[model samples]
Each structure stands twice: as structure tokens, then as C-alpha cells.
Target: MQDITLASAAEIAAAVSSGTVSARTAVSAALDKIARLDPRVNSFTDVVAGRALARAEALDAARGRGEPLGPLAGVPFAAKNLFDVAGLPTRAGARINRERPPSERDATLIARLEAAGAVLVGALNMGEYAYDFTGENVHDGDSHNPHALGHMTGGSSGGSGAALAAGLVPLTLGSDTNGSIRVPSAFCGCFGLKPTYGRLTRAGSFPFVGSLDHLGPMARCVADLALAYDAMQGPDPEDPAASPRPAEPALPGLETGIGGLRIAVAGGYFARGGDADAFAAVAKVARALGADGTVEIPEAARARAAAYLITSAEGATLHLDRLRTRASDFDPAVRDRLIAGAMVPATWVERAQRFRRWYRDAVLRLFESVDVILAPSTPCRAPLAGQKTFVLDGVELPVRANIGVFTQPISFIGLPVAAVPVRIDDGLPLGVQVIAAPWREATALRVARALERDGVAAAPAAILS
Candidate 1:
């Protein structure tokens, strides 16, 4: 019974579909866990206890009547507050939208998941407007890491990250601008997939930086991530940014071996960073991948600079008018950064776009030599809860963007990355990243599976003293 609480959505669904466990039974168990554990961690902003039980009862009835069930039938899930669940206004962890009407319909992705029979648990919290990376939400309250109480969970998917890590839910939806999905996944010791740009529909999800915002799945294990992503990705006529291309399932290559694969370990900025633990996590994956050698993204430092410019400029432009009119409504932790983004020169944005073209080409060239690139997910385990000014190679950086040093450059190039947790044994969780070429999400999942099968990723804190 204790072990069942941590089962993946995939496992739970199979059990429920077979009638070994009913949806109501699963929801009841999960809700019990949330009640017991969440107060200690405060991972969720709200938990929909009544709504979930009702849905579970419906699924149990449908199954009893010999009705067809969806892929995620009866599995419990949640999304960041930025994603609109039906009848719930997308507050996005801010006060400005308090007067806004409740969301009339679920975000497309949320609707699809609900249709697939996954029960909605509640709306998780976030860094307001997805504006900050440190998960410090002055408006919504901070989401703490489940592994350690006083540490920050990476944001704006921070709530989903923390909740999933705490076993509150098996699957969660989180959006990424640069590293929102992967960073929190890294910090919280879970699996998060930042799908290719436009691979997953963004319709109905509140916009952060329209150009870069990507909604993705976060979960406790690789198989669960695949299940959620497979259900989410497809051509949605309503979403212009969603690919018109036909739906491609993510489950096909999950069990495939990584034979004859080209693997490279990244260093330079990726290697030398905040804590030695981060680099060690990357090294463990490199060794598992049979890495040939190192691949340096030349001028990576410049690439990171360019990414920040585009992020801030575009982010500021998106919130500029509202920010001006309702300055007091914004979260202070992220306000100055958003303002800075507004001030970046327009020419810098164009230059960054051109640099994106260059950087993508450089990454593609590297991919020609390697099937996957292994890198650190977060520089250090979530920096001691509320502390500011993390040290990276003895150089100080602001809390927000600094954690994304490796992730930003990769995201700027539109890469697909799988953040897989690695051992950090210091009472803090850590993860490593596996990046693959565009549309090569299969390759990334395969590498992640290999790591899991080979026992590289241990179960969280199996022997905590």
C-alpha cells in the first residue's frame, strides 16, 4: 500500500483498466497522501478534493458498464496555475487577474487530458506570469522543494515540480520558456520533458513570452512522461502555433536500446558551475552513455547572453502595458527582471534571433557527430531554500537566470531535452539533462530509459539517515 502511492500513472492506469483497482480507490488513496504530506511541503496552492472524487466515481461507473476508457483513465493529474482548468480562472499566481472571470473552458491540452480520463486534482502554483526562474512567487507564495523543506523548487512550474516530487500527483503539466519545465524537474528529482517548440499545443494556456512559451508534461518517471505527452501532442486546428503535422506518439522508442548511438558530454560552462555535485551528476550520465569525448558549443557564453536578451525583451513587451497600469499587482521577486527585459534594445532581440539561427546550426552540426548531448540540469541542488546570489565557478549571479545557464542556450536553439534525476545524496535532489536533435525526442527518451534500466537513477532517498 505504501509502495502503491508512488506508482507511475502508467502503472496505475493499467491496474485501473484491469479492474484490479478502481478510479475511486486510487483517488481516495492519493488524496489521503496529499492530506498527510502536502502540509509539510506546501507544494500545491489548491487541492480539488471534491472535484477529483466525483470524476473518479464516474470513471468507476463507466468501467463497470463496459464503456470504452481513455489512455489515462482514472489517473490523477494537475497543471500549473497558468494552465486554465475548466471553470477556473487562470490566476497565474498574481493579483491583477483576480477580477478576471473563471476560465470558460479548459486549455486545449487540459481538455485533451480530461477527455483521456485523467482526473484533475487541482491547480498548482507558479512564479507569477512565469516571469521568474527561482520559484519565488511574491503573489502566490513560494513552492518548496519536497526533498528538502527550506529549498526553492524551480519555477514557474515550481508547484508541479514540488507536488510531483512529494508524490501528490503522478503526472503534471508545466510550461517552459527557457527551463521552467526542466529546471524544476531537475531540482525536484522527477522526469520533465520540454517538447519541441510547437510540438505540444499552447492554446488556452496563459502566455508568458508568446514566442518561447512551451507547455509540457512533468511526472515522477519516464514512462509517465511518455503517457502524458502522447496524449497531449497532436494537430490542433485552434492553435496556430501547434504543428499541423499529424500526431506522433512518444511511446514507441521508450523501451528501445541506445546501441550504436553517438553520445557527447558537455563541459566548459556546463561543467564548471555552482556546486561540484552538479558536474558529477552530468559525468555519471556521460559514462553510462559511453560518451566519446566533449563537445563545446563555441562561444556558449555569448549564446547565454543572447538568450537573456531575447527572453527579457520579449517578456517585457508581452506584459508592458499591464505592468505599467497595474505595477503594484506584479510579484516583486520577478518585477525588476521583467522590467529589465522590457528595456533590452530591439536590435539586440534581432541579433539574438540571428544568433539563434547560428546556434541551431552549430547544435545540428554537433548532433551529426553525436546522437545525444548529456549536460547538467541545475548547477546546484535548489540553493538552500530562500538564499539569493548563487556562486558559479566563484562568480556570483542573480538567482533567477543563473540556474538556467546551461538550459537557456539549448532552449534558445529550440532543442528537446529530457531532464532525468541523478543522485545528489546531500539531502537535496539533482538531475542531468539529455538533449537530442529536433524531432528526435525518441532518441532522448531512449537514452533516459537506458540510464533508468542500468540503475543510474536511484529511487529518491532510499536510505536516508
Candidate 2:
């Protein structure tokens, strides 16, 4: 039987639209799932069942009145804790903000989703201040990889990934800064897209690095992701960072084959020692896509290092005051990252920014010859929770920074990516990344849908699994 939890967002919308299922039914199933699994997974900081029910009832009433509705009408969703939700602290999983009062309005992204008729289920968990890569939020407790409860769930957006993977919700919002969104999606075996920086508006959400933070959808399939992405794109004057481009809908040209597309397989940093499962997954994608050629992102080592420096420095600057006086309040693991960012020299920060521009142009140059770039989302599947180190391609890595190798450089340049998961040999999840040029989320989604058609997307995760 087709699992109700595994149904794609599109299927749910159609069911609700046709009255085969009520919005209330969807919300009830999701809340029931959260209630049962969340205690073990810790994917949510709070599940607002009562509030969500009221909102769904209001939406159902409007539908009964024959009022027009948007594409996502009646769908249940969750926001990364960083996004403001009325009457919630937007604590962002940090002890630092625990005492802060409830918010006055929805973050722009949340507001947009609500306007489209998606109900806010509740706030998802995340790394404190969005700083760490592992899903262990010291303040909020570790969000287990429901895909493989023993393993980690990738960072920052870990809760979003976990909730979706554990069947708590079909759609959730997560941000990527140095790969937060994609990594979690990769490990959790779900589809996550980090639209080009600024392609989707960012106001009313908390900032991570400001330069690299990107908010987008995490879901079970590509078409549904495209639906959510279509709704989130476009400009809001309040966000100077949001691009002024018109919103691009997901319906156009989505199922086309990639026959003429030049898909490049990267060497160097991207091909190194992830687990055998990582390369195995990448191999499957290459075969399915009929990739045109292999290419190298030269100077990848330097690029990765520079990206780390830039992110650390900027992140520290963002929280300098808090760090100076309220240092003890931060998760000790991330406190060092903030401190390291603060200690870097001013000149290095500027130099990293200059290099960022140079790297962006170089990536653009690569795109001139290729339609998509393929790489492992993380070097490996989620690590054991609490461990801070791993070996990749034969080198030891600081667990926090190592996962970003493939994901960060692409995101640093404002590229849009679809983190598409593959099956795991050991019953965990594995994900590979598909990156397209700026403002090309549709292109990314199209290619991801192609992969799904080829059978590389995640299987239906069962409650028992």
C-alpha cells in the first residue's frame, strides 16, 4: 500500500483539492506522526498541534466558502527555528535567546507559504545559531537521523531533514550556510534545494553568515520541491539581499530529459575519500544521467580553505557582542567557531571576500560549458552522534568543517542545488548534489526529477525503519 506519510506534497495537495482528504486529515496525520516519533528523533523543538488544527480549520472554512486558494493550500509544513512565527521566540535552538519573547509576525518565507495556504506545523530544531554541521544541538538535544537513528543527521538544518525523513512532515524549511540544508538532506535521504543566494527573499528570518545563508524547501520528491520553490522566489524590499527577479513557477518544462545537457563530473576535492557508499551513489547518478564529461574545479583546496575563513570571520562578526558578554550561553562546540571567526585578522577577511568574487566568476566559467555539476553532498553519510572527527579520502577532518567540502564552494558562489538522496548499503541514507547556475532552481529541479525517474531518489521511509 502507498504510505500516507510517503505521499508527495503534490499528491497531498491534489487530494485536499479534490476532497478525497481534508486539510484537517493531513494535519492530524502529521501531528500524530510527530507525537509518536519526535520523542525518539528530537526533530522538532515544539509541535504546535493545537495551533495548527485551528489554522487548518480556518483554511477548510475558507474553502467551504468557495474562496480562491493557492497551490499549497491545506499542506502541512514546518520552519527552521530561525524563522519568526507569531507568539514563538524563534529561539533558533540557542540558550542565548531562550528568554526572548514571542515574535510579532511570520518571517517573509513563512508568511509567503501561509499565504499560499500551507499551514505552519511548528518550529523545527537546528544547530545553535546555525553554526554546526552535526545535528547535535547542545541546547535542544541531538536530532537523531531517523533514517539511521544511530547516525548523525547533518547540521544546522538537521531538524528539517530529520522531521521530513522521519515522516513528520512532507515539506520543511531549512537554511544553508556552508551546506547546512544540503548536507542534512543528503544524510537524511530527502530532497533539499538551496536556491541561489538572494533568489528567494530572506527577510523575517535570522541571519547566519548573511552572505551565504539560503533558505529553501526540503521534501520527499522534486516536483513538490519545485512547487514550494516557485512560491518562495521573488523580491521583498525589506530584504536588500533578496533578488529583485520575478518569481519563477515550477510547472514549466519540468520533465524534459537531459539529453543535450552537459553534465560534468568533478574531480579533485569532490572525488576524494567519502565512504564507498558515497562514490557508489555518485556512480549511479552518472550512469543514469549519461554525463557528458569529467571536469575539475581547479584550486579546490584553496577555495575550501578560503570559504572556511570567510564563513568563520563573518559569523563571528555577526555575534561579537553576544560572544563577548554571553559566551557561556552558546553551545561550547560552536562558541569556539565564533571565537575563531572573531580572532582572524581584518585583512584576511577582505582577501577572502576578494577571492570569493574570483571564485564566483570561475564557477560561472565552468557553467558556460556545462548545464549541471554533480558531486557528493557530503564526503560520507552521517557520523555517530557526539564524534567530532572523521577520515575522508585518507585525511582526518574536524567533524564540524569537513562536511562542507563539496557543498560550501558551490553555495559560496550563489549556485542553486538539489540535494538528492540515494539508497544506503547499510540501511542509512546517502545523497548526491546537483548544482545549477544562479536563478536556475527550475533547471536543478528538472535534472533532479530526471534522477528520480531513473530511481535514485529516496525510498519511502517507514516508521519502523
Candidate 3:
């Protein structure tokens, strides 16, 4: 069972599909691991063990009937609490959302994964209301880093990252709005893909900044990420933001290598504002990829500011009624931010939106010369849990808000980003963001695969005592 839990999602799928392992066996392995390890990590808010076993039994019965299995046959996985799971309230990282009735059906992504033969394990923890950079949920307890249990697993997809790293599950779905996916990926030492905005459906997940929120997969390896990502491709009529483009499978071309792709390191704004470990991680990947040179994306700082403004205003508006009715029920940190956002002048938001378009064009222009841009995913490795501040480049700043400084600019424009964990000698692993043009997740994954092949990046299963 431990070996089953340690296997990658792709490996698990192939083994189960070949009848080497039963779906029930795999799901039971995952549930058992979660039961033992999650109490310390606090990665899950709900573990639907009974549902998982029943789903697995159904799959095993189908296999016995000689039915065709999907690409992700018998793989066990979970989702950020924000994604609706039938019979459970979609928490969206806030206690306030628990008041909502249980969902009648799973979120579109969840349904899609099950259709592909992946078993739904449960829903993981997250930053409250997805309005957080730190995984500390004032309501649900913090999701601890698997590498160092007392450290932070960056949020709002913190639980997704922690679970993957702890080997509780091989694949998990998470939302990336203002670095939710990438930050946790960086801190927890895993592979996370934030597909080009609207590339994946958000039909059943809770919204935190609809314009910026994106749903994608987090896994222990690039292959697992690709397998899950390819399986979820397709537009849903239910999601207005879902792109109309036909499904494009990234797996077939994933290992084609980066011989013809032009890669460059992001400089200027990305080059600074980080500690030595962060910059060194980017340098190591750059050397391994034989990147051509450093290229600057103009006005990135401005773009990050614009992203924050839009996230605040839109998020506040979405919860205006809840804010008015249940202010005390909300997390103090999240509630205060939303309250302040409600007061932001509309003209400022408008200007920010206008500048966002201009900044996106600037980033797009850079991609015209380089196929991929490599940069630090987080300014530093996972910080100690509850440590409030850090010094970067001789300036001290709040830890929670600043963790996404490098990630916000890229996600601001809705570009595809793959966060790959870099191995460090003694400390927690660092991460690099392999960014590509809009809808170009293939390129980013290809680069990440290269790093993995060279052993420069890896998400090794955490050593549990």
C-alpha cells in the first residue's frame, strides 16, 4: 500500500488498467495514508473514505466486465475545498461558505476526472476564501509543509501542495488566483500547472477573482501533471470563461525535448526581490536548459499592483452580501482585506484594468522572441510557520503578501505557468516558474520535463517519521 501511494499517478493508472492492481486497493492505500499522515500536516478538511472505496469498487467491477478504461484509470486524487464535491459543502476555504447546502453533483473538473477513471479521494484544505497567500486559515487550521512540518505551505492551494508532497495523493486539483497554485507548489516542492486562464472550466468551483482565478493540476511529477491536464482539456458550455478551442493533448509531445524551443531567463523585476536560494534555483535551471539570455518584461511591478487591485475589488463585490451579513464569521485577515477592497475607488480599478491590458501586451511581446521564460516561483523557500516578516534585498516586508511577488505578474496576464521544484542541498526545495505564451502549456511542461530529466528538479516523497 505504501508503494502504491508512492507511485506516480501515471504509473498507478497504467498498473490498474493492466489489472496489476485493483482500484479499491489503490484508493484504500491513499485513504490509509491520509488517515495516518494528514493529522500532522492538516492538509485535508474532509476525507470521503466511504465514497472513495465505493467509486473504486465500481471501477473494479467495470474492469471485470472488460469495459474500456479511461486514460487515468483507477488513480486516486482530490481537489481544493473550493471545488464542489457532491454531498459535501464547498468550503472555498471559508467557514461562511459552509452554510451553503451540499452540492448535488461534483464540480465540472471533478466529474471530468472521474470520467477519465480517477477516483475522488476527498477535498483538501485551503486559505480562507482563497484570499490568502499563506496557507494559514484562521478557521480550518494551517496546511503544514511536508518537508518541514512547522513551515508554511504557500496558499490558497496549500493543501493541494502538502498532500501531493506528503504522498497522500499523487494528483490534486487547485485554483490559481494571484499565485495560489504556484506559491504552494514552490513551497511544498511539487509540480503545479496553472493552465492559461479559461483553458480549464471553473463552472463548479467557488470564485475568488473570476477574471484571475484559474483551475489546474498539482502532482508529484511532470508526467502526472500532464496526464491529469490532458484528461481535463475541453470547453464546457456551462463556463462562460472556458475557451472554445478544441482539446489539445500535451502528453504525446511532452518528451519531444526542447532542442528547437528558445528559452530565456526573466530579468529586471524578476531578478531581484528574492533571496539567494530563489535566484540560485533559477540560475541552475537556466544553465541546464542552455537558455539564450535574460529578457525583461516591462512594467511587471505595475502589473502585480494591478492584479492586486482587481483581485480585491472583484472579490469584495462577489461577497458583498456575505460581508454585510456575516462579517464576524469571516477570517479576520481575509475580512479586513475584503472590507478595504469594498472602499477602493472605481476609477482606480478602471485604471488598473486599462494598465493590465497594456502590461499583457508587453509580456506577449517578450514571448515573440523567447518561447519560454524561467523565473523564481517564490522569493524564498518555505518560511517558518507563523513567522510574520522577512528581509529581502535588505528590505523587510510582510511574508504573506510578498510570497507571490514573482508569480503575480505572469498570472496577471492569464498566461500558462508550470511551477517545478528545484532540489536544494539542505533546506526546503525551491521552485521555478516555467512560463509560456497564452494557451501554450505544452511549451512550459516540455521545459519542466527537461529539468526533471536532468535531475535538476524533483518532488521527492517526504520522509515521514
Best by lDDT: 3
lDDT of 1 by residue, 1-465 (tens): 345557778778888888988999888887888788777766677778898999999999999998977889889898888888767778887888666798888898988898888998888888888876777777667887877778888887988888887877889999998899888988888888988888889988888877678889988778788888888878887778778877778688788788888888886767766588888888888887788899887667888888788877887888899779988778775677888888788877998889878877877898878888888887888887678787777788877768887788787777888889888455666788899988777778788888888878643521111
Q: Residues 1-465, candidate 2: write the lDDT tens digits.
A: 155556777777777766677788888888887887789999899777888899888877877888765788778899999998888898877998878888998898898888888888999999999987888888889899886688899889999998888888889999998899999998888899999888888888888888888888998888878888888777889988888889887657788867688898877777875778888888888888888778788677777788888888989999999999999999887899889889999999888889888888887888899989889898887899888788876878888878777887788778899889887465677888888888888888888998888787764554443
TM-score of each: 0.95, 0.97, 0.99
Return the lDDT, model 1, position 72.
Answer: 92
Worst 10 residues of 1 by lDDT: 456-465
lDDT of all predictions, in order shown? 0.81, 0.84, 0.92
Cα distance off (Å), candidate 2, residue 238 = 0.9
The better candidate by lDDT, 2 or 3, is 3
Candidate 2 regions with alpha-carbon error over 4 angstroms: 1-3, 424-426, 463-465
Candidate 2 colliding pairs = 133-155, 273-393
Looking at model 1, residue 283 earns an lDDT score of 82
Deviation in Å, model 3, residue 12 alpha carbon: 0.9
Let me know the TM-score candidate 1 reaches against the reference structure: 0.95
Given candidate 1, what's the lDDT at residue 212?
77
